[model samples]
Target: MTTGAPTPAYRTSTSQQPRRSRLRTLLPLGLAAWLVLEIWLLTVVAGAAGGFTVFLLLLAGFLLGAMVIKRAGRRAFKNLNEALQRGTAPGQGGGNGLMMLGGLLLMIPGLASDALGLLLLLPPVQKAVGAYAERRLRQATPGTLGDAFQQARIHRPDGKVVPGEVIRDEQ
Candidate 1:
């Protein structure tokens, strides 16, 4: 007797939908609002004495913060690599999708966005995340993926068994 499920199709398109990310949609609006508010605050603080000085200070702060991030980012990646080389699981993560997003957020031109990105890029924070991931990986059963793929690699023809890549004898 045959089961009722339909035969599965082999070929299918697996492309993801083209939708703007939620953060991408919201971040620009948030940055614009923050820029307006900061400008207003700077005007109020400077108040007829010297608004230009406040703007200059803001510019200086932005430059200093960017420099700090550049330096720290380099250090964090270097240490992360060292940890991996020493055979201890690195606290910091590389090739993580979220961390990449955080880096992109840092590349935004405004102080607020840059600050948020830098916070995300912090080594301690990344390390904590990496530790959690390592724990999960350690707890997983070994050979699960290997067994699944091994079963797939077996070949069966006409109800007779064949294993691995099938090679035919040349006539």
Candidate 2:
């Protein structure tokens, strides 16, 4: 005999739609808006300073983005090395990851994204974002940071914890 009442019927709530569906609906709209705004800004700048100036600005932006990407990439590698040497997980709080993201954003060809990338590269903003990410990750996981640090095995398909090790074979 069943021990409890029947389960309620499965019902879909309007607010419970999958995140991918929501993103699919919003992505096109956002892209169109960005294109329109970019075009408008381009026209205004061209009218004020001529087409050559606009071209120069775009070229300058591209150069700046390249430089930012190069610098951020180097810094991220440095941070990763330091973390490894200290026996800690790299990007424990997501700062290095965010820095890489910011650099990639800068690489993208758009004024708004470049501005956002520059902001994300700032030390204060990176710290804030890292803290927020760490908090969210902690809330989503079952164990404390210490437990995560101590974990050095992988759960296999049969539910056995296999010891994890990195092996490099040079031919």
Candidate 3:
């Protein structure tokens, strides 16, 4: 009892340090594999259907993706106008963002990406992806609204951090 060591409070906890995500390690590798696959598929198609056909296909995909993006943007603007006219917030669940994402993927010049984009353009796929994204966001910030704002907060629009305090009144 006389021979004393530092208490647990004096020791630093490793848990307090931020953990690395698997995605950080695996994403590069995954992208490399995908690139290789895309190249291989393109070569195979070229061998079967000539180089000009691939060029035509890519051009068509680019044009279609552009059209899709333009349409989605217009629709989103129209929805915003309609909401402003009604003096109410715009309703959600239109999948316009997903459509834009699909368009982007389609324009990427890879058949696999085009296929994935087309899949994302589908209503059911958009619903499933949106649900999954929502769940992931909820999980990432488990307690977003309440005590998370107790300390200094970051302003989203300007990316500024300012000190602040939360005031509560008890009855």
Ranking by lDDT: 3, 2, 1
TM-score of each: 0.39, 0.61, 0.72
Q: Which model scores highest in TM-score?
A: 3
Clashes of each: 1, 0, 0
126-148: candidate 2 lDDT, tens digit per residue: 99888887789878997976677
RMSD of each: 11.5, 9.3, 9.0
Candidate 3 lDDT trough over 10 residues, lowest sum: 147-156
Stretches of candidate 2 above 4 Å error? Answer: 1-20, 86-88, 91-94, 138-171
Which whole-number lDDT from 0 to 100 does residue 170 have in model 2? 90
- Rate residue 49 of model 3 by lDDT: 100
In model 1, pairs of residues that clash are 91-127
Model 2, TM vs. native: 0.61
lDDT (10s digit) by residue, model 1, range 1-171? 887988877645456546789999999999789889656665676885586775665566566556655665776788788998999966633535345545565554444555565666677877776777768976885566678677656744456656657589999
* Better-scoring candidate (lDDT), 2 or 3: 3
Question: lDDT (0-100) at residue 88 of candidate 2?
Answer: 89
Stretches of candidate 1 exceeding 4 Å from the true structure: 1-29, 93-171
TM-score of 3: 0.72
